[model samples]
Target: APAPPAKKPEIKAREGFEVDGQESDDLPPVFTTVPTKEKIVFLTIDDGAEKDPAFLRMMSELKIPYTVFLTDEEIKDDYGYFKKMQARGVTLNNHTLSHPYLPALSYEEQKHEICGMQDVMEKRYGKRPVLFRPPFGNYDRDTLRAAKSCGIEYAPIWSEEVFVDHWEYREWDQDLHPGDIVLTHFRGTDDWDG
Candidate 1:
């Protein structure tokens, strides 16, 4: 049998964005990429629109680690699918309650969307996540403030995006890099032409 996966390294937040476990005046940092030189890229899947059993089995067998940001509206139909993922050690973070564009909503509205999901996740998943991702990678100051108030410590966007058949890059080099955060949606053949 193959060797067990190595223990993951402790991830330290980028300087000036570190959380000291105490409240601060600054909003949580919004970073598109991490600060590191390791030859590793974080995979983050957004929305819980698809619940393909084969995909779940493949990832489990392959031992690929990933993080998920779920919108309550999309996953409400099958929370059990994600509960299985959680049991397998996948960390599910907040993607708001309805995946609304945070920049368009009032501060109170944004809080409701973010905090509401925090409550749902805590109630359903047994733990609330400290990380959050604003829908569509869009956010304003109010969005960050609301997320902070909801106990979100980091709000990261993506440096690259992957689809069923193609990839998108935000950098001019158009290539993957160390510490990059790659984004993908919970989609299958039903949602895209694979």
Candidate 2:
């Protein structure tokens, strides 16, 4: 019999980035980047429109660690696709039920969009997500409030966005910094220009 792989060390949240009991009502800390000097960046993919097998194979082969923020409206089409991703040790977080522009929605509507997805995730994925990303990176206070009510503890916007052809950065310098959160969508050649 072959030797089993060694267990990986746990990654802890940075100081002041802790979630539980850190805020009143547990409203999630919103940030575009994690404050760290380590040579590490976070890769997050949004939505669930594409189910490219090659992408999954590449990530798995590369041993890349990434997170997925899924919208029920898109992922409900193929829940098993993400299940395979989960089996790869990926954590699926909440985007929303329908990926609506949350600021325009009333409080109740926003809660429905957020909390409803939390329910769907718990039912289908076996865990309620603690992280959320608002659609289009647009949100308001009500969005955070609703998300907190749904048990979300962190809401992150991207410091950089990755498209097929080029990358977009939030900073004036077109470069990546330590602790930067890079965002990408579940898009392929048909959806973006290469």
Candidate 3:
């Protein structure tokens, strides 16, 4: 009989957040946080409702790196705004075509929503993204299948979400952990007074 393939060894991080180093080609990557001892956190901004130049300036001055998950409907009116951010080295990812609930839709519908956004992002930003976030942080098995078919490499949900002045935590501790992914949306003073 033929010998079975040896298991890939896992690489441990010295400090800070690290993803499991074991490589698997068949499985799609789904992550909430990278496992590590470092005190680092990742910030992800969803939607594109507000295009605040001051906010951009502040983030740029702070040198914070965040990923933006843009919806076509929210950003089509001011695509140039995101273009400026992209020029500043910020990454723009896919949220969906119209921000529909993925689990509510069929697999083909889900694929259309995701792939359509990918087409728009590539046409507007000149690069196809490999990161996706379903609308309302809702998805199902078909969503993953659709995302994988569309070439997404990672799908992550938030550990915490921040509004204009307060934070909402998914964890009961209400405290941040290493490699935590934070979520925030684009909103103006109308949405929540700052």
> Candidate 3 residues 128-191, lDDT tens each?
9988987887776677778878788677777889987789987789899987889999988888
Model 2 spans > 4 angstroms off = 1-26
TM-score of every prediction relative to native: 0.88, 0.86, 0.85
Backbone clashes for every candidate come to 0, 0, 1
Inter-residue clash pairs, candidate 1:
none
lDDT by residue (1-194, candidate 1, tens digit) is 23323764344434444444423656677677776567778899999998988878999999998899999999999999999999988999999999997878998999999999999999999999999998998887788788889789888888899997789998899999977999999987788988
lDDT of 2: 0.85
Candidate with best TM-score: 1
Of 2 and 3, the candidate ahead on TM-score is 2
The lDDT values for all models are 0.85, 0.85, 0.80
What TM-score does prediction 1 earn? 0.88
Pairs with backbone N, CA or C atoms under 3 Å apart (clashes), candidate 3: 16-38
